[model samples]
Target: METDRKYLFTTRIPVRWGDMDFYGHVNNTVYFRFFEQARVEWIEGEGFRVGPDVPTGAVIINADCTFLLPVNYPATVLVKMYAGQPGRSSVMTWYELYVEGDERLYATGSSKVVWMDTRTGKSVPLPDTLRARFD
Candidate 1:
């Protein structure tokens, strides 16, 4: 997979006091939300629909993040995400978080989601509409 694909996304996020846990850093759970928001924003920017296309859908099967550094409050953060290698029914995505002012890397992660037929609850192939949007 091309690691450079992440350069395709641009998402700015404000650091909220509530997002920090007892560790004085953004909680681990919050990273998932940030990644999701970034992906949605990127899709919207590309003019792609996130909902079921012709009554089909996708679900995340696996996701993981590796924290390289802590992100504290009072600083803005930026998250960048991009599609990775496409599979028969799934696509991997890469995500990176960095401090806005200094570009300090805080974390990196990836997620794999599988397209599925909502009615039957079985994996399905990526539709042309969806694939083209990512491509």
Candidate 2:
């Protein structure tokens, strides 16, 4: 990842024993949960509430993760998330996971979320208020 790019949100998550696989390292699938936690926090921090009644928000359309190092239990992971360039109806969200108190990266991930009308399940343009938060 580029050192120059600034992250918009960051949070610490404790690794649970159940998060590990038979190999004793965090499972590959668990990384997406970490990304989801950070993304939800970032969206709420930007003043968007995700609920049944909420009319505007985003739905993840695509997601990916690249593991650089194995993560074990008894560790607190720091996750940093940033909003990339926004398109007409979607925005890219990038994530980086690291061992707490250490700078080295453990994994990197990204997701593309499409803005939509929650009630109708139809795509919508990114709201200016939400887009401005990325700036």
lDDT by residue (4-103, candidate 2, tens digit) is: 4456899999999999999999999999999999988878877889777888888999999999999998899999997777778987888999999788
**Candidate 2, position 61, lDDT:** 90
Give per-residue CA lDDT, model 1, range 1-135, as digits (tens).
Answer: 365453558699998999999989999988888888887777667664677653566578888899889889988889988786577888888888898987678998888878788878899897776677666
How do all models score by TM-score? 0.83, 0.91
Residue 34 of model 1, lDDT score = 87
RMSD of each candidate?
2.6, 1.8
- The window of 10 residues in a row where model 2 has the poorest summed lDDT is 1-10
- Candidate 1 TM-score, true structure as reference: 0.83
